[model samples]
Target: MLGTHRHLRGLVGGVAVVAAVAAGAAAHASAAPAPAANGAAAPAATTQKVLFDDTKAETAGNADWIISTSIPDPTKQNASPSKETDWTGALSAWGVALQKTGDYTLDTLGSGNTITYGTGGALDLKNFNTFVLDEPNNQLSAAEKTAVMQFVQNGGGLFLISDHKGSDRDNDGWDSPQVIQDLMSNNGVDNNDPFGVSDDDLDISSGTPTAINDSSDPVLNGSFGKVTSSEIDSGTTWTLHPSDNANAKGLLYTSGSSGNTGVFFATSTYGSGRVAFWGDSSPVDDGTGESGNTLYNGWNTDSNAALALNATAWLGGGSSGGGTGGTTAGSTTGTTSGTTSGTTSGTTSGTTGGTGGCTSGQLLTNPGFESGTSGWTATSGIINTATKEPAHTGSYKAWLDGYGKATTDTASQSVSIPSGCTTANASFWLHVDTAETSTSTAYDTLKVQVLNSSGTVLGTLATFSNLSHNTGYAQHTYSLAAYAGQTVTLKFTGVEDAQDQTSFVVDDTAVNVS
Candidate 1:
């Protein structure tokens, strides 16, 4: 359920208190935080990219998603595209906010991209850091699912905006709810462990949904302040399973059928990436639209605009120096270049026995390579001490060949297995930057192998090649239950062909035994 609040106007605990104050009142209530008093430091802005999805046949490819307009709307319908009517699109206000405060560039994926991967015409997931899929009425193909999953697993942000179960805009066989379910369930994705949550089976047709007062969450408070109210015309909800994923959080909730609770907004983590799911798309619409089409003054009607902006900022790498507005870290509202800083936590520095050298569940020492590769054996390549590319977790990661090199590299770390432990799991983050072809004959590959204490290869855990096409760091998990009772070594072998180059990076090596 959505957690408690301090002084929300329309929500109390888990129940809706009242219809959001009139549109004008909401605007006055949810205004951006005032500028710093007495010339104090202002919140800085984050520069990021957001890609709206249009490949799913949304509104006949018009998508109705764009940034806000600078001009006023006309009395009559203006169907043709023009700068004056940019407000007619659903995401106009959101895009405008990103441009003004967050320094974010927003664009839509055209029909040509096609959402598929590895078919020679597949959309390149590396081009954008965040992907927004709203009101998808088409079923996702296997390739599309794999592409999206891999994209998110590799530190990409995904915003899933769905609608009511049967609110199929197009008369196609698929709907937003069903397609989202397919994406999160094993039945369609063909994996034992899915994304770990699915939408709740409830459609609220009457009252609106109250934003849960979650002050601690960055998404609720980040650029927009607190999210108090959202217009939910007719929307569904989500159900979070903490057993499957420990990071799932319910951001919006309401009374469900039979006096139970329902969650309409939820956030979770898939591998090293972040995900947010909103139940409805109407909250993004701006009143302008063609005649005979349903419209909503959602951006100004409630805290909808602020909610969208906050969600976007959170999805784009959480807080940037914990700053806001367009101010650089040490500069005034307009200047740039003041140095962006981040902290690294939980590094292994000599301790042993648990995951990442922790006292209990930690297992690997110097797993992040922050201590200059003290715990691992390397061949042909070395730890990348320079902070060129961001590490998946800590401050350091092993670079197989420093990109653009045609050479083989190997890195290995040994772990002691507890005799009483019945389950063991090995996981790490890997980044692949390659110039090789992603076809059947791809030669630059990263192979994960398990070796017994006697220097004998037990098995090959997995092989990642250019066919998967991950341009960012993605978490790879392999079960080490087969070596539970014996000490073994996990080795990452990067093989590069003589022609093209591939850089294989490994970081945050961890083994959980219990």
Candidate 2:
């Protein structure tokens, strides 16, 4: 797949579109507009880190996809002339946008730490809030898949990008389609929907694929800009199974030749994390390609640049336009059944239902673990009441990885949200002090998960790490408005490294509904 000259042959609408030829056309001279935030100053990007994966033999070149080399003219043109430096060519623009906005720090994974799951020799998802896999040429190892799935479940963002079928650039048994299919399937996303409908399939589409604007999707009508349309050269399409993943939403679609509509881009929430999938690599391609097959200008065309930024923002726990999981500090509007005539108070116990009934205050189950793990379920590791120094509230709080066992410990509780809850809030105090070394490579972490009835992780509410450098207990809150009328589970997990000890303490966990 290294610079394969195939888009011209795959032109749609019977029109021949070639990247090499397109670059030779009338060139537009322009620079990318300055990064803006709703006509205001763009926020500092220091907090978020975007990790690009080059471990799965992403392409033929080692530095080809590196963001540092991707510098393209903002004006319209064909393939970028800086192919060697801009290996991913226009695709580098995506990273450039994120970097320029100072919204995120872009990094890449090279030959070291091959992506593995539950292992110390691979990429540690804990270091990053989002992961980007663009056009991986090789199949992922079982550990890699596990790492990705669990990472998302534990509240990490993932961007799964793929090209058309037979895009086996390295002649590997896996393409993006097969790899993603397997990844999603193993993670409870079925290749087929219930009632025997095949919803998780991928195929190649011909011609210039029109980008479907789903206004409801934050990636489209996001804070960056309202994405109206985008162009695709030759790309593949993916189908989503919302019936299986309730948080799954199609953001971009293309009507193919055989009465088939292809999903160009889609977003879904898994456990507290967000996942987005795009079907083409050309959208980020510059003019660089292998040998004679160069790509066209995609980063500057349409809303591709904005799309990249918006996607990054959303995945990084921020939104372009108040989309799902926006990190902005404010109360979110959740879907409420009806207006409440009164304020409701809740208690500190009860697993299945709001047993204490509803009151006018926050609710929790032994918020301080003073009553032991009565309402919560401990699955693994040492998750019990601990009488240690620096208790945020009472004499005891929940302690995980307590014994320095080098394990993954978890404790969870189910809560029944009361009716007339127009909005809800879940807050907790966290304390972390660890002896683990290397913030990026270490596995010691504390993850907060949200689960549905079937115990399937719906979203990752939050993730805490010793890397945070918290001097003491800190208060963290998440909007539970998304779960206003439902019964959900809150899972607290502690993942420790094999060597040093990491202590994760939690107390004063509260859920408030109004």
Residue 429 local lDDT, model 2: 64
Which model scores highest in lDDT? 1
TM-score of each: 0.55, 0.56
Any idea what lDDT model 1 has? 0.56
For model 1, residues 212-309, the per-residue Cα lDDT tens digits are 65454566666566677676777787776643443566776654421123766777655434688888887887766544556666777667776777
lDDT of 2 by residue, 6-78 (tens): 1111111111111111121112110111224432123443456567887766655421444543222211232
lDDT of each: 0.56, 0.53
Reference-based lDDT, residue 339, model 1? 17
